[model samples]
Target: MNSIEVEHLTKKFGDFIAVNDISFQVKEGEIFGFLGANGAGKTTAIKMMSGLLQPTSGTAMVAGYDVITQSKLIKRNIGYMSQRFSLYNDLTVFENMQLFGTIYKIPRRELKDRIMDSLARLDMTKQANLLVNSIPLGWKQKLAFATAILHKPKIVFLDEPTSGVDPIVRREFWNLIYETASTGVTILVTTHYMDEAEYCHRISIMADGVIRLLGTPEELKKQVGVNTINDVFVEYVKH
Candidate 1:
């Protein structure tokens, strides 16, 4: 089953197009990577699918809701985390979780259990009272991700997640992403890291606001006569 279906999706700012007519489908429980350089329209496409921005043309269904008419429902059923830290820095970890739980309107009884489960999964229970700003960059990112999915949204949109973290932290972050995807929650992530692209089940590489390539990492490499995803990316994106 497809968790996301986008067809002929486009976004225009007056006469300039940010995302041209693009189409793709992300299967349920799959890690779908949107790979591109800066200003490649990845963010625009993501915003449209996440219901943060209205599209100029075309159609998309996210978490089974139409992007145009049912955006409010779409927002309720999806989680989003960006490259920049999204949690309240002054709020303690537990408090941050509480704020989001309330925002998601999770039941009081269920919220407590969800908070404990998320903190434990990240091994962050011990630091529950610590302010978000007091944590390391990696930990903050992990906590942000944990909180984003605290309400158990059907799909999660991760925009440039793991951008500034070290290799070890990046690996740990990906582990969390894999864990989330394992539970049948669809994941749509945008990244510039080629190695990270390899972690995705499938990837769509955007160039000049258009998806130039779409396939599994190995398939892309084979098609381009390259040995690695990094080479395949360079071959397709740098041309």
Candidate 2:
């Protein structure tokens, strides 16, 4: 079964429609990109799929659990890293990991191994004791991602994860994401960066409140007859 499935999903905020009847599916282990301009409803749609917000209509399923009816199960099956990193500035890296470990109810022995593995993967084992505020933004972002998936969730949601990071760091971050996906973890990532969209196996582009296009990177390029996703996005937005 697909890791994520959305059928005519919609979310409204009073008089404003944040996400209109949009639908898409993400297969297991696939890297699916959600792309749009600012205020294009990417975040809102993700929030609904992640079960952080309820949809006004239609349905979504994540990891074999219904989003609206089985929100708790969905929460347990998914990891989320928001645009802000969401790490406590005062907390040490190890301390922050420990806290999330407890919240996720990971066993003590397993948690220790997982923490060690995560630190090693991030190459931050030596700096585990340092406060989050002392680390560079890129490292902090990586740490946040490690924390989010520490519990080995079935899917991970990254909302504009590479927004403010340097290009080198962003490329490194994408490498980590690629490595994670190799382990059968589905990734539903949202970003406004057109370059990053090309890296995904498939992408859905949102405009106003609905998805205007869904296709592979190559297919999207061919459809718009453009060399880059930026030009494709611009072409759509203009019309």
C-alpha RMSD of each candidate structure in angstroms: 0.8, 0.9
- What would the per-residue lDDT of candidate 2 be over residues 130-204, giving only the tens digit for each residue? 999999999999999999999999999999999899999999999999999999999989987888988899998
Per-residue lDDT for 13 in model 1?
A: 98
TM-scores for the candidates = 0.98, 0.98
What candidate 1 gets wrong by more than 4 Å, as runs, is none
- Candidate 2: pairs in clash: none
What's the CA error at residue 12 for candidate 2, in Å? 1.5
TM-score between candidate 2 and the true structure: 0.98
